[model samples]
Target: MDELIDHSFKLIAKILYFLVRIFAWLIFEFLYEEIAWWLGWCICRAITLNSRPTVGINGYDEATTTTRFVVCFTGIATIILAGTILAIYISANAT
Candidate 1:
């Protein structure tokens, strides 16, 4: 009788495991494509923003533009990349 009960419990646990797996798969599979597209868009935007040429307004010296642009781009790219990495780490840890 004890053996039978143990076997039945094992079977129930297996079923529950499979059910959870299936549910997670369904949720992720449905959202994966949209999530990928949005992530790609965000990365592309970040890259473009970082690499775009800087337009100087009044009082801006052409000689200093390149240096300033490089500094700004480096700072912005660093922040963006760091934020993205942190977000991914947080999400991965959450799961």
Candidate 2:
């Protein structure tokens, strides 16, 4: 009985790990890629057109800014969001 319980626990742990990994990959591929690419494109285009857009309260662009700032901001935002999500999962699962 004890061995069975331990095996069950191990299986559950493996499943959880797999789920988290899949979730992370999906987020990186879909959410992260979309936001990063869109931001990169917007930043490059703004730089090409010579516009100065500032970071809005929610990180939206009322106008635009330099390529460096745009890419930096987008990267930072993506990291922050991804980290926040990972933190939430970690904290929730911590026992």
Best by TM-score: 2
TM-score of each: 0.38, 0.52
Tens-digit lDDT string for candidate 1 (1-95): 99999999999999999999999998754443233333433444477774433332221234265544454445556557889999999999995
Clash tally for model 2: 3
TM-score of 1: 0.38
lDDT of 1: 0.57
**Predicted structure with the largest lDDT when compared to the true one:** 2
Could you give candidate 2's per-residue lDDT for residues 1-95 as a string of tens digits?
A: 99999999999999999999999999866554456646654654466574433433234343344544556566657668889999999999999
**Alpha-carbon local distance difference test for all models:** 0.57, 0.64
